[model samples]
Target: MPDPELPVITLEELGVLRAVHVRGTDSVEVELTPTYTGCPAIEAMSTDIERVLREHGMRKVSVHTVLSPAWSTDDISAEGRRKLREFGIAPPRVRQASGPKEPVAVELGPTRTSRPVAGPPELAPVPDPVCCPHCGSADTELLSRFSSTACKALRRCLACREPFDHFKEL
Candidate 1:
């Protein structure tokens, strides 16, 4: 089934549909991971899965929400990213590798609060610019941190001057 939020790509391509297993002749089990905790689409997705599977002749369909391996933006497939761009949404950058040797790293380089503190401010790591999916320009500015959906950020391209939603990094 296609992702409800980003209909341009299927749930399989989005990496949300983790696995499918057949317990018996007519019973099937599906594993799904949500993009984030308390994702609003999970219910809809689950219902869709059950209906589709049942229509396909499965007497019983069970969709289990798996949260052990938390979902990330990196879970998106290359094809899914291309579809997102074609759909006029900037895809998120791949931030981490999925391996036991490599772990998710966080760097609190610098921060500014109401008050100042200490020596000269240290520079934080700069993130690669989010390229405009339409104009293919790296000259885009964030208009809002949260767009129509919490998972996306609204931005406008300097070259095209068109406002668009960007799938935010998880």
Candidate 2:
């Protein structure tokens, strides 16, 4: 069930929630996808989940990896979002189209209408409509694309002049 107090994130943002199941009379299995293909927490997370399941009487627990659907922030439960915000990271923005536009061609000839040459592809997702956690300000600026952790980015609110971490959309 979804929680009401928090925002929502796509599954890609959550990265993976790996299905857990029983493999035998007392065994359990789980599937997962690393956040960046080589997440360092996989081993620890797997161990913790398995141990918890075993303590609940499961004899065995196995982990399986799935890469097709590719996780997204959309799958994050509302409760999870609350946890993230409570942990000081802003939840990812909801997915929405920015409106229709023409695609740029590689050829440099004057084939399109009047417009300046486009720049390289954006490496990071667009900034969230972020509000300051400290003073509830809408004015904010990106301080760094990467934070102390791989999943977060550093930002500062112009109104409150407070720095914060934002959970980047995957």
Candidate 3:
């Protein structure tokens, strides 16, 4: 089924449909992983899954949320990424197999911020450029840390002057 928010992708494409198990030939149990903690779409997805199963003549349907191992952006299928781009949304960058290389160093000097920060000057390392899904240009600027969903960030492409949502990494 298509995701309620991002209808361009399916639950399996989003990598949240972790597993399904048949128990005692009468009931079925589904395992799901949320994109992030406290994801609101999780409930809707679960309900949809249960309803669909029920329609298929399954009386007992259960959807169990899984948190262990966590959900990673890398879980997004290649088809999902293509779909996101086709739908004008920037998909999350594929994480390096070698893992993140750059580490945000704690600067002991004055940093660029309006308020006096308490912790490290840079809370996170400079993120890789979020390319424009429409123009496929790397010239983009982050508009907000959060967008329509917590799992996505708002970004504007400098090349095409278009605003789009980018699936957040991790």
The whole-model lDDT of each prediction reads: 0.86, 0.61, 0.83
What lDDT tens digits, residue by residue, belong to model 3 across residues 45-69?
A: 9999999988988889999999976
lDDT head-to-head 1 vs 3, winner = 1
Question: What TM-score against the true fold does each predicted structure earn?
Answer: 0.86, 0.69, 0.80
- Candidate 2 segments whose C-alpha is farther than 4 A from its true place: 1-15, 96-128
Residues 1-170, candidate 1, lDDT per residue (tens digit)? 89988889999989899999998889999999999999999999999999999998999899999996888888899999999999999999888655532355653422211122444545444577899998899888878778889999898898989988899887
Ranked by lDDT from best down, the candidates are 1, 3, 2
